[model samples]
Target: MAKINKRRKRIFNMLKSHPQGLNGEAISQQLGVSSRTIRSDIKALQDALGQYNIRIFSSPTKGYRFSQFEHLSSIEHELFKDNMSNLETSKQRINYILYKLLANTLNDISITQNDLAEEMYISLSTLKIHLNEVKNILKKYDLRVTQYKTKGIKISGEETKLRYCIVDIKNIHLENEFFQDLIMNIDTDLLDDIIKKVLSERKLQLTDRSQKKLCMYIAIAMQRSRNNKTVVYPSSLTNKIENTFEYNVAKEIIENIYNQLNVDLSCSEVYYITQCLLASKKLIDVSESINKKRVKNLVNIILKEIHEKLSIDFTNDEYLIDGLTLHLNIALTRIQFQMNIRNELLETIKNDYPLAFQMGVIAGKIVEQYDNIKINENEIGYIALHFGAALSRNGIKENIQAKNIIIVCSSGLGISVLLKAKVEEYFHNRLNVVKVLPGYEVNEKTLENIDYILSTVPLKNIASDKIIKINRMLQKEDVENIENKIFHKKDTDLMEITTFFN
Candidate 1:
């Protein structure tokens, strides 16, 4: 009778009461729609509120909530001010199916194809397209969807593989309130207490995100173990990690889980948790024992490769070298254990730092040659950040004149240096490269001395007209773009004028 969808009104009411927020799953369960549909409804609601002075804020781990709505009574009045639409985009439907399948996998449930399609309110043809995508994603974790004639589909893989899928699925919806709630229901209070004590005693500090992730993984491990699905590490690997301080901390945490949650952990479970801790950060003692010669040699090799490929010299960048070495130590541990770290700004980096991303790709090959572990895009993205910073530091000089410009390359040094060389060669005294930065590092403060921002990536939300996006490798089109911006003239006429003068 209200004309508002029951789900939309219900979600609004829930968020109104729970200021903290709720994940998609929590809203879906109450509304009887897929989490995918809930996500779409939230987006629609947010768009509808554009006329009002209200906003919806989402947390990477906490779902969504209303912002700028101080009066509680005002929310219900505005619940459906605009006509609510129920259009589910193809992408949203795919995400919904992924969520549903992963949820079913975690709970060891099976679903028929017909039932899945019916639940998602889609046709069999559309459902298959989404399922194919899900299958591809699952393949990355070495899991597969097997179907029986009578029984719909179930995820099949090793216990470890299944758990990794679960972890990945958790990461995919990091901002889901339902997932956060699930993590909270697993005796997190006691787990956090034990973690704080262990980390404090070890003098290790983790950022808030890192701390949340560490706790979540521990909780996940406990849950899986309670389900008799503990990860089994190789004997040699277990023996190696069992001697470390992290292992001791993990063992203590597991013991506490037993005492508080009544879940007993096998040795393998302890070992698996240790790998999670080691993969997250480097322990002081562990850092001290890292193969200095090997790390130094690897750094030198990477630097040399970067220089050869891009003509960007980072040999003198002590900060870059030190940061990279430290990162490598932690990265190797994560790689060894097949743990993946999220690069939250990866899209921004890729879009803003094409040159740097290329440098990362080349550098990744060099690391694989030396370190023997294949590097994924996420890890390479981090590598690009270091190079981007180093490129900026190496190029920026305060004495450069008013024509000074900073190049932003999200990928790293190779593109920055190449672009700077091209600009100097072509523009001569017209423009100068005072700095080259990654997108994430370029801020208002960094732009103080800058006349123009030449970037391979877009600088979103920046009001400055000085920002220019260029090709990763300077092309004729890119040169023309620079000419148009800097000279305010056609390149052909400008070149003719310079040619006549020469």
Candidate 2:
């Protein structure tokens, strides 16, 4: 399994670099794996990348290119439904549970060894072994498990390290086929009600459209909870409500039950719960009646928990916070649209981290939009491809060196020294600095072959071509502006024109 994972990572990297994808035969040779194994690996990569709006395609001439990255922003708006179909196996469910458990424990500071054991219903020895294994897995990324008696057990590491651990664990768990089968069998309705209640108690509103969406999201979450991949949506509600208002209210109640009690209901399980919410929504406009303070508290709790537990800090940027609050209110407007609640938050995310967030949102949206679509990690590979492409297009340009120029300043010290430091900081990699020429020792040879001149003191009767004026004192902004001008210059020749005072 480790070997397979390594091969997958290598193949992913190779594909990312070679956007016009590599052939299976080439991949096999590169990884030293059999063609059969490469074929399977390709399929897995495709499924993983699907969520990111990346698709791998084979062609006679071009070989392969992740064709989706260019339009991932648009493509990710719709869910990839194809990937949803294969998630029904039993092994998939186990993997899902394992990942969720690990993610939850790693994120939560309140969770301890005993708490994990009890929650998992495993013996202490088994729990310890499992945690040890998890720790071993985390060690690869320089992340460590620190068991604190006061703070509880927590995974301590940098943000990037934590992300790697989470993504790896989730990927491995989702690859289980048995859990996928089990997920396919779980009832969606019961799961939906449970999710709705959780949202409502958290003060997140769902419109009619969102209510259904939330139900689906919950179904997915529940399926994930059970270590399964597929969720079964029910055809009809068991207890039908007379009025729409009443039904919406009842939906809230069912959602509440699921949130408070971990007893998730299948569509069959929460048929009545759906009816009640629908009826309540029709009869009473509970939107106005909801306590504002309570809602605020709920949102805070959810966001705080997600941040602390997941180590996924959705930084409280002003725009992001405002956007989340706006979306939360919009979701509360109608219980039916509750599931669509996160859409606005996602939109806000796009605004903040235009590249990465947009990519993630688009990938998620594509999966939500399409049913039965299988996307894999190759989609992320494609995003990386596009990112690289963008960088290549817009990043720094190299200049052809006319002559190697060396800079000299007074005494290698003092305010003239500070000027030297600024010049070095700005042009260290781009230009070569030889030695500092003090005022008394300065000679014509020092200026002899120098292509350009930078000086704090005025030089008399020196080579006219070698003289350029520089400020005696350099400011912070001066350094920044100079670097920016050099790095972003459209004309390459201007790169060598180092006029310090200007």
Candidate 3:
């Protein structure tokens, strides 16, 4: 039986003997446990009983009562009986408290190691041991829980990386229950109001996106600050605005207003401009920067290079150009941030664009420089953008229609899905996948008109003129091979080379 069930049974027994019911203090005294422990036990019992028609209620003067005990099923009784032994051990309780302390300290800026030990009611040596364990857990996700003599232990990593790391940790340790309880106790609606007031005081109107990003940044910054390391500043606010708005018109509006008001366009200055742009009733041309002629020319050059070098056709479209440009800027920003270099965007583009994988390769290089950091191929949006930017600058014009490919696999659904994910990761917006057909379901008729064929199993009937065999598990070399095969066909169209940017 679980420990909680045993405690609940004991409480029910006590109430039955008392007739009027036992108050919290009486139960705690009788059970030889702290009031807090008893309360927690009561909550656990309530949760357990709630699954059935059984109900436990509390009266301010009379204390907790089993109001509908008769309605409980034999199965419920058995289940509750089984849960008696699951009550947390004293050591587990200590660990829980220690985890909470670490989480809170990670969200504070000025707390020191000594301060943390005091707050957690533990000796410095004991605190250090607990912190070391937390740090080891954090290291698996390429994050570190660092401590300084002047500051307490705190988590540090890239924002998105750290967010995912936290998600992992929460899943592993089942810490969501504790967080849920903590959040439940707070007035979140009131907190939102308070945040709005705070932003208003700073003369900033926090848009939904800014509010969310700022919150995340502040949380992570505080975590890093607790380790006595200077937190990295967010990317230049202008870049964020441009990426979010994706138009110069919004920027122009702000620039004109600032000129009239004589307000210097500082990082903080853009916040209000973003708010105004979002509030505007007028719908300006968001795609005005996307030049169709320029995009067509760039697409043609890329297609030509693919035909001569690797033999693949990417139907160049306006969407691809916009997507690629956005990705490129983000990649450049990430590289600059990693290198701790400010205002070196042009240098990053000039030096890295010639590489085969473009921004993806560059991002991998940056990740290699950081200790224990790993960049998965799935996170290579910036690489796609770099390719787009390169094409734009070279001004090679081509018109190619986008094509769809269906993969066939006999290695089962799981492996087929993995390969599909890898293909999507590498190709980004370049490839359109119609579906993954199992080898048994594949027919020559179905495969005849497919743009490309990727298969884990040997083709029984070759119908498609273009077919590429890939392993069930995709590797880096495999991605390169696939790229080479797709771009090396002779009949693919080539375009006259021109500068990407005019």
Candidate 4:
């Protein structure tokens, strides 16, 4: 028997459990050590394991996992028992439960609820609540939870829906608070980097959130493919997606991931990834989409339907038009592929914003009528979130005293268009953006009637308090600055916003 260093023992345990591997970033976070120190430790551990057949393989993408293993369990007592992070939040626990149940189903294995609860370090009573939440989420994908006498609970569904369910669940990512456990047993960072680079090269667009989601799907698809489980689309549907741009993008992404992870996904995986892209909230120029007659007509119909049904007028609201045009195009793809996500915020939206939800239902029905397909509660809830924003915008117009504002951007055209739109859309007549001027163009007359000069760079000779510096892309704090400094929105009326639609 050889004496092992304390740090090397812990690293060995993490490598043993994480079959897929962890990047230096993830491993360092888990171990509370510097990446430089981790690199040294991995080297020392590799030398120690040389006598055994175990070898550590590193990839630029996947970090490190064992490349070879034999009789490694013989040294198990020399290492710490477990390196998995404890499930703390309800978010983390439910995500963990979903992964275990789904992974077990794919592997054709079963364990009792007692066994699972023990494995997760949770009480059986507590597990029931988490399991119930998981069951409700599964229902959205036509997946049902099944219990067995000896084997614990398992998800029962079509192969395709099961994979979609996994994809829809964004693995519990708690940043610095979590380690080795939150990723549903796989590192998504590698996949995310692969997908991000692919999309950038191809010039396709996805929001940051959507890109993370696509990575989640790819990670799950790769794991399941390893388990010999795969998504099967109808040949006609598959053929249709195969010819699309998203399919080409998926092919490239998967090829890159294959090179990194050494996992060759079934061809159907490519088509499924294409469907994920279509169902994703695609970011595109509103001006470009509004010209499409179908999207324009659909937006018009949705706006008219909401107005007629709710007596709220938004027919000419360009923000709403832009929002719906972008959303409905993706909704149409989601509907086509039957890709539905259980919106975690759906219940909150319905309870807190009834009128907004009603508007969403109305909008959903219009989409259904336009395409002759039913929109699920999940989709309706998403539509409602946007409607809720519009309602809030409409409500605040009356209460908040409108302020004149100027935006100063150097070269002001491209970036200012987006910033100006975001400010106008969010403030919605509360802060009137009087003009966008370059720093060189900021004269006294340009500053007249302007309450705040929202600028990317500080203008010389301008009063510091009067000029609010903002990112080229409007960020959370930038919005907060405008809200607190310009509008004094915290002191603004709350009554109209809560009671207006009622």
lDDT of 4 at 71: 58
Tens-place lDDT digits, model 4, residues 1-502: 2224455667787887888888888888988889997898788777766766678899998889987554568856544244234456887788777767766776777768887765565679999999999899889779988876666667788987876665555344334232223245555777777887787788675644466677777777777777788876788888767766688888998899789867788898898888788766554422221135787788888888777777889997787676666666666666777676556557876897788789888888787776789888878877776676565555444325668788876421223445666677677768777766556446666666667788877677766577889976577899987887776775565654766766
lDDT of 4 at 223: 71
lDDT of each: 0.69, 0.44, 0.48, 0.70
- Candidate 3 has its poorest 10 consecutive residues by lDDT at 279-288
Write the residue-wise lDDT of candidate 2 on 258-285 in tens digits: 6654645444324333322322211012
Q: C-alpha displacement of 359 in model 3, angstroms? A: 12
Best by lDDT: 4
Window of ten residues with lowest summed lDDT in model 4:
282-291
lDDT tens per residue, model 1, 88-164 = 67766666666666666556788898877755556799889988998998898888989856878987888766766
Where model 2 places Cα greater than 4 Å from the true spot, the runs are 1-3, 7-185, 189-209, 220-288, 291-502
lDDT of 4 at 319: 70
Candidate 2: give its CA RMSD in angstroms. 26.0
Candidate 3: tens digits of C-alpha lDDT, residues 1-502? 1234456667756755665557999899988889897787777667766666566678889887776555443545564443323324544434543345435544454446665554443468876776676566667656766554565555556544454344334434554354333222223343334434444443333324334333333333323333542323355744554554323433443354345433234433243333333322111113222334543454445545554554433445454444443332333333332311112123433354444345345545444443235544433433433343334323333223535778765432223434565576666655666777655345677766767877766776665556778875566766766666776522232232333434
Off by over 4 Å in 3: 1-102, 106-137, 140-142, 146-175, 181-309, 315-322, 330-375, 381-502
For all predicted structures, in order, the TM-scores are 0.58, 0.21, 0.33, 0.58
Clashing pairs in 1: 23-177, 60-175, 352-457, 353-410, 356-411, 356-412, 357-411, 396-434
Model 3 scores what on Cα lDDT?
A: 0.48
